[model samples]
Target: MMTVVHHRTVDVGGQAVFYREAGDATAPAVVLLHGAPASSFMFRGLIPLLADRYHVVAPDLLGFGYSAMPPVERFDYTFGALTDAVEGFLDTIGIRRCALYVQDYGAPVGWRLALRDATRITAVVSQNGNAYTEGFVDSFWKPLWDYAEDMTEEKAAPLRGALSLEGIRWQYTHGVPDTSLVSPDTWMHDHMLVSRPGSMDVQLKLFSEYPTNVALYPQVQEYFRTTQVPLLAVWGRNDEIFGPDGARAFRRDLPDAEVHLLDGGHFLLESELPAVTALMRDFLGRALPV
Candidate 1:
């Protein structure tokens, strides 16, 4: 029988955390953590593909998606807080150990989870999720990093377009060779979410705290070397942000880690949905062939 995405909400210490679950609970799970300006919605198309063999759960971080979007002023938007929220969700849902699939902003949150409790991680699949300092290349992140240092209205003003209709549209379409493959509804939905009152503030707070994740790279790399968790890193070579170098870095720490770079952009799943599905399904089978 085919499994459909199941919409469910669980209260994680009074916070209503929303997630999409599929497949059998008894099977090994694949926890999908989405990136910024997006939620579990990004994983909608990818979930059912793997649901047959693996339990899949994708949650929106505290400030993103349909999850409770508390005001930035009221809630802590740091990566640490985000990880805590995710850990709580895992606990509440009775998911003790699972494979982690991290993409974009999901990188920091998921990596922190793995580092905090390495034993809970069955394996890791990194898709355009970067951890190395070198991964933050000059092309995509330099301007954002500059804005982070100053954080003045003037400095941040230049980046406001990223939250706009066209900007969010560009985020999904830009690096892909065939722009037609990108869906307009993807950005249109995202624009509506960020357009909500106070969402921008939450984004800005998280953007400024990105350096914290960078600082954690040392610890993350150390965890990789010591724990030697099975890893499968599939990157989009065309991604301007979190470029291919980040994918290759896994080999430095875990030489046996399987890595593949595909011809897609930051939101590679958008453009290479079938290809990514095939790669992930195959990788998971090999990486966790028990």
Candidate 2:
């Protein structure tokens, strides 16, 4: 039987938070959090595959996808604020405990959720979701690093290019050995949302506060070491934004963490969906039993 994924929205602190949900309401939950420039849409393929065994939920974070985008002037665009919104979303949606499938920008948000309430997280599945300094690919991050060092319009101007169609397309195709495997729709959808009016500023505001995430790495690692929560890292070995080292670094804190490196890019699901899906199924089956 084909699992039906539902498109829905809920009021999270007065904001209309959009999400995709599937599987049984009574089943164990798996929340998928997306990266920058993308949304719950990225999990379109993985949701149904997991829905057979687990209740899968993927939310479009505020300022991304169909979620309400409060103006940067009114909203604090830091990871902390994003986490609070996600926490509130989970509460409003009645998800008390679940595994977290985090990628890119979702890593910080997921980690914050864990920090705020470790008891609510059953396991973690990180796909190119970096948390350690070792994960950084200096070349790709230098520009952002420069901007973070000096928060000025001049410094932030160059970063806007990443919001362009070409730049967004490159993120999807960059490390994939076979570009044909990637669907054009992925980048197109992302570019559409990211290029929306005022979206660039929202992203920039989040970018400017990225340093805070890096600073919280120590605390996150401590949580890992202490909690010893089940963790699986399926990384795109060729990801230029976050190298495989970041995936391996998890072992430093949680030696039992499972790490797998596949040939792909930052957007591993775009090129290696099958492999990623299989790994998640196996990991979650054991880590978060139904």
Q: Please report the candidate that would top TM-score against the real structure.
A: 2
Cα-based TM-score, every candidate: 0.97, 0.98
Query: What would the per-residue lDDT of candidate 2 be over residues 134-179, giving only the tens digit for each residue?
Result: 9999988988989998988888877888778998898999999999
Could you list the CA RMSD of all candidates, in the order they appear?
1.2, 0.8
Q: What's model 1's overall lDDT?
A: 0.88
Q: lDDT: which candidate is best?
A: 2
Which stretch of 10 consecutive residues in model 1 shows the poorest summed lDDT?
A: 134-143
lDDT score for residue 34 of model 1: 97
Worst window of 10 by summed lDDT in candidate 2: 155-164
Q: Which pairs, if any, clash in model 1?
A: none
Number of clashing pairs per prediction, in order: 0, 0
After superposition, candidate 2 runs with Cα above 4 Å error: none
Residue pairs with backbone overlap in model 2: none
Candidates in order have lDDT scores of 0.88, 0.93
